[model samples]
Target: MKRKRIPNKKWAAPVLGLALVLPAALPAQAATPAQAAVKSIEFVGMNAPAGAQQMAQVYTGASVKVTYGDGTVKTFPLAYKQLFKSTDSVGGTIAGVSVDANGKPIMDTSAPNNPVPYVSDAPDANSLFQVPGMSPTSLGGNPLSLVTHYEYITSNNAGDSAYGLVPASMSLTKIDQNKTTGELTPVELQKVDFSGVDGLWIPCNGSLTPWNTHLGSEEYEADARAYEADPTQTYLSSFVQNYYQDTTKKGNPYDYNYIVEVSVDQDNKASAVKHYSLGRFSHELAKVAPDGKTVYFGDDGGNTMLFMYVADKAQDLSAGTLYAAKWIQTSAANGGSANLEWISLGHATDDEIRAEIDKGLTFSDIFETSDKPADGFATIKTYPSGKTEYLKLKPGMEKAAAFLESRRYAAMLGATSEFNKMEGVTLNAKDKKAYIAMSYVEKSMEKDSKGADPVDDIHVDKISSGVTYELSLGGGQKDRSGEAIASDYVPQTMKGLLWGEDLSAPDAKGDTAADDKVANPDNLSYSEQLRTLFIGEDSGMHANNYVWAYNIDTGKLSRILSTPSGAEATGLQAVEDLNGFSYVMSNLQHPGDEMIVPDPLKTEVLNNIDANFNNRKSGVVGYVSGIPSMEQIAAAAPEESGGGQISSPADDSLIPLRDTAQAAGAKVDWHGKNKEVVVTKGTHTLRLNVGEKTALLDGKSVSLPVVTQFSKGKVMFPSGVWDQFAKL
Candidate 1:
């Protein structure tokens, strides 16, 4: 590993000036690099040029990421090629006057003396606002596309696993878009399938190695076909990718439950290390410490175990000790939950349980022979044909003969969670600690179940499972003088904290009523991001799709990635976009959530149409709380329980324009009579002289001043917007 100072055209001025130090190299054993989390990225006014027929301008507020690593990152030179990227100015344009859902202008894309090319046509012409795929659970966010989910690997639930795998290729061809204005610019970048990076077992999530390779987790070697066909049925290829797919097709075929060590070459050829040397069992994620030799990983599904591999040599994944977390659960109590704490059969102090697991294999047999060891636990074995088939632990202790030589690991690491164990893991080399992302799976019925009632005027239910939390690990070595729990690993940093945001208001002020169900990613979409431990979860215990972010330092959630809005994004291994936007990639279904649905053409039509015609120029749209509907009065009854009625004391902050409007002596009818409404044709102001029973445009009689209006998102008007009601 060498450090090359590639002068970056974009970061040269700001970054290079700082003269940051680069951690040149680490021992072959060191696994991952500390990615300094984003400290701040100041919004760089958008100015990229698009090469299109129409003069398009680009705009955006650019921000910088302050890596958690040593402050040595003074300057980062961005070269399209150094990072394997290509781009050009074509297709689409930045909105010269981008508006919020309320139709108020935000960014002005077209400015004089500016020089970014705008295109006439949007590349993908059919995609508009397409919703996502089938959700695994009822409490999750809207089912977005595979692209939106950004799932790097497709599990049996979302994809077909024919030949024990659902084979997919990660390659390239289009940008089709850039977040800019007017027929904007286009950048062409080729997809790279690093050499030895093909066979995908469990396409879960993981970070890139210094070697520029992907360390993917493979759950196990179960029947994925069965899982796909029916969750009720005992399918053999449970999590296999290519289980049911035709594997005869070479180069890119076959996948299973085994952590795949794959990489893409500069030439786009995918290579697979198809050896079953890495331990298996619902492998969820893999994170290599700075010491590549000492890689740490965790098992997610049925069993909640944390294991680390001490690679014998650099780059070699085989021949290592697999140790599980064994906590001194003397602190355990019966909280009357589904949480379980079982000791390892290999080292279970409980003779009964140890003997049970041992019935299948001795400590070493779990690794050596692919065959089951003559052991204890019936649960760990299955007699197939006349031979006993045991769980394949892989390369390290595959045979009982070798079990005598392999190192043993304690199974129970005192992880406290009800239902599902750990779902995400992130290691920080600079701090020498591991951040574990845990989902309660059901903290009172999850986050979005019927009872969560996310709306502002809320009738909330006791939640079953909507907890976001983490576990921290200390340096591996025990503290000097190994007297009691004497390892450097201390329990100082492990605990669950309250995560739901008490969003005072969805907006700066109260207007369109607030809803937690639509705000915080953690609460809204089960998505979060702190430093880097990204957690992908089901919205609730019952709802299955989600993404969460965990900061390794404080062990708290930070931000959240978008949901699997539709087909374009699903099963993604998230990476940051230039603007902190998450980008996911996969080779499963044709329509993923990654790209906009209906295609760019549809999006252009929809965005443009919504921006242009969907505006209400009149000071007000519609007023609520003033004239209560039958349903509103019913809703109000419950509010009394919380505190007061809808007409509770008005907080000035909540009514941003109340003072100015009050001074004008304008009343409710003034909305339609005093000002003009912006229609597709033009603004139309009404006269105040209309009498009662005036003929309505569509036969609904309005007291002349009463009218209907349209705008973006939603707006709740004040009594001052109109004069009087004239229904019926």
Candidate 2:
């Protein structure tokens, strides 16, 4: 094999008093100088320009100050790009729309254009799953895909809160990425069919599973107890019945509020299943920890309790043990701090719970209620919303009650149900910390609300604008019953990380909170490589919601994105790297939704939305661009490395299977029967058949510039075949 040397571009050194070590491998050059590595990136914060906040569009004026090992500082401004909107029809159908029995599009006659996009007013939660072995350039290819869930639709332009009135939906969109410019485009969208699970209900915030599936939610679960007493008492059940559009069929309140997992194949087909074992409540989202089995949930409604579900097996949420946190408040300052202790609720499998639901068990079957504290009834408790209830568990309904009436059961078990509007839960694996977004820190979490509550664990000052809390993770913890907890990733303590301040009066832009700080932090995604935590706002306090990037290392807060006036900054997911590029996925919902926009700016905001979006009826799913890849960030850290050759260029260039695949953090396997070599990483898979001029990438056949060969106990593939996995 004759080696060819490509010209190497030298990076100037000693630019900013920083030195980075370069890893070896330089195209077989005779004497290639070490390229300067990236040392760090400092994000320079920028204020939202005056007129931009008054418009109905996503905006970002933030820039990243990158420092090279050689001390050179380069600035890359954060850019926002919308791949698609809820109102935009993709694949001949608008996302988040209801269908009649005949499959006709259900129209919102009151709104312009007539096509109904459910929760177009509240598009939330985005999960980007990269299919293994699939590439953007592959045959009929869809390597990268996005699954976005809509929370709920508004009845009118004033944004009146009406939830569980219709079956919400999540969309699976195939994404196309430009190899050269790193631009992401939505190629096609297919609404995930939830008919198997009786249709999705208020699908809210979601997270991507470690196994590359979208874990969505059915929030604002119907009150089954109330529904049993009166058929019209439950909102979600009747709507779900309407979703079925069948006269004889009745919606079961128990079926509409559980964790929904949607798995997408390489061909872009999606299938969803409801995990009943995770317990049902007003679920914001369930985030699985790095351990895979340990899951944490964000219960969105008032009087919500923090929850954790440890699955019986890794990558499976069908069966788990549910536990509620008892917040042992340590300090009341800055939105409070607490040492958490887990109180075991019970354990059950999805099948068991499903069987129970199939049996038509009502709330009366699981619990007994009383207006006062009787001998059998539990003590009276006040909800964070100021409602009072007295309940007692039935003798044989522990599992049934825990899995079905999770909120009431947790409260009955002495768990702290003080969290208000807990929105999103995300993790920083490197730091072993979990960050939870409290959209508004008030209600039962405040000191004044303890008058009627038996358990007053949280007693922090009211900060209605909200705060983000960091939970420290540790091992060797036991449940309150003294039983050793199985998972080591349990959260030990929690403290406020970042917060928003409520202003005494409205700001110049008509915002009740300071424009510079975060208001109503709702969605969160953390990037360990970037050392930054991304916070998305769902704020009525601020005229325009913004997505801010908080650097954990530098302690600098940078406003990276500003959504349209009266819109919510939701669907936040930070992808450290995908096909060698990084992205911070963000979406804006319900522009011009501000019913409280000050009189001076209300008209201007609405006018801008009419000119841009579909008169505040549309929401966008997109990402923050111009971020460096994980490979580049990893190269920034100082390290010593021995040089190694990667390619052997003969008359026909050949690439070493192990060296090349391992370099990409991929695993290589050989099949003797098929005489094939397979490389897999995450959701991607690459397969090479010996002597064939074609290779299979995530099941799609791709042409090889040269055939693969097995020679002398070693299998080597052509550079062209190898390049398919690396190149766009």
Candidate 3:
């Protein structure tokens, strides 16, 4: 059944209430029940950036719906909070940046972790590249204190050929949480030193492992085959020269382009390790299955292959068997559907691969290649950027070829290498499903000409905006070799869930795609508790990229966020429960990027950004706020239903003490000596004497309308005192 699509419009009203569903009619009553559950939350979508004043604005408001156990429904308006910006200094250094003494970014091999600040020519990051991946974690801290550890990745230093060479850095921040309203305040930001693994390269989207570690990726890996042939090559091979600070030293391409796992200690110190067991490629991100042993990879870039790794033991990624996907297309409509079969590409241990890289094993030592057809060489066209080559594996080089030249070898063995711009992978553990974001539905994904060199398996119509495919997970499946797969989390089939709508012509805002739907969906994160998938866009087609919330059960798509014009929406991490509160992390990169913006509106967008974001030099790392806890939302219904008295926090005369005080993260204590009540949050304190219409605030006596009292063991206080706690 086709679901009705929600059109995009400029929300005229401050709050738009949307009730997803309601329960059956309840008996008429004098009051509604106190306990209510959150039925669904639908955020209002903002219009495309228009005039100069609105181009750099970020929407931070939403409407939430709550349903009580007795079937009574209500709606609430909430606002999002901004924690910090990229230009904000952390431990005296800007987030995701490194500079010299003169404050100029060092892009050469003079020092490590410092690259060209600004990148042009694409609708991507500006001076401060996006913090694409963030993992919010708690490291054995006080449960009541609400302390969270956040580690985010900076994708690259610059765009075009200068990308993937300079090593990227991951930053760790300690945040203080307010339990009452679920607000986050940053305490400190520290760079997680990656020199232990010779620094990180192009770390992109990442995920948190089941054991609580940040699993990151290194995208656009330097071509080891090309570099081995011409050691003096300046473009891609310069990654080693820049890192070692010595161009004369022999560079080893195998040392980079692997999954990097970072662990943070209780003191907030961080350590990293590169998992070479995972095959080298243009890795966007990897998602570990609920079972921990099965892992899925989203290899970014053109002509990429879908890869999976199954570890020998749970929680250990050191040794695993790698497999590539073969798409058996069942339908070519709506981004296509495929029943997948895995082809084993061999496996090895991380220690062994590291040893080979240390020994300086070149590409020629692993395989023999020829320009024309030969007796031993096989026709394989799986090189990065779509290069075809004739190659034959040498004896005893199976493990080397599998780990280093994974894509080329996979194609030689009959695996699908036609996926374009596969960006991020996320799992819906509750439903046993996984999602992969295809940033572009073009190139090899489309049907080819009759005389094309090699036939392609995936042949779907082009949708420039992109598609997010959902894969069903199941067990008892075998690989193409008929060998029993060890893990039960293998994906069986894949189909499109959220697809973008490409416009026949440019819209008024010069957007080539519909402003309402997702365009170039890149980042994905799923919340099992909410049954919603959060998507972030990396689109050049849309004037202002957006972040969306898609509810799986109801097929409802809500545009929850919109970044500044020319900026990419990224850093999407959804936390279902953090000290009883829920949060969704959505960040922006490169405001006022004018790569694809029409010439007419370029000056307006730039001027607006200059007024708001320091001349388009800032990017934000923050999360949506005001999300009520599931525990608070699941209020039980009274057995005998009645019309409940509703009280707005803004104008209520009387308020319940327990709910109000706890919601404010304030502690309430009974004082028996004076027969009074005491409330405290931070440094502020309030004391109320029973039967007296007066209160003491910070030792100053203040008049109150009503005296503090108790009703059936529940404390009740005047709503006027609410402001005293709020100010704290």
Candidate with best TM-score: 2
lDDT of 2 by residue, 171-262 (tens): 88888777555678777788788878887777778999888899998876777866787768667554755577665666778987889999
> Candidate 1: misplaced stretches above 4 Å?
1-165, 168-199, 220-255, 329-421, 442-469, 476-493, 497-537, 541-561, 564-728
List the candidate 2 regions with Cα displacement exceeding 4 Å: 1-36, 52-54, 100-104, 109-119, 133-142, 156-162, 247-249, 380-386, 632-728
Give one digit per residue, the lDDT tens place, for model 3 in 49-100.
4565665677644555655444555555555566677767755655655322
If ranked by TM-score, best first, what sequence of candidates would result?
A: 2, 3, 1
| Worst 10-residue lDDT window, candidate 3 | 1-10
Supply every candidate's count of residue pairs whose N, Cα or C atoms clash at under 3 angstroms.
Answer: 202, 10, 11
Question: Which has the greatest lDDT?
Answer: 2
> For candidate 2, what is the lDDT?
0.72
Worst 10 residues of 1 by lDDT: 8-17
* TM-score for each candidate, following the candidate numbering: 0.39, 0.82, 0.76
Q: After superposition, how far is residue 506 of candidate 3 from its true place, in Å?
A: 0.5
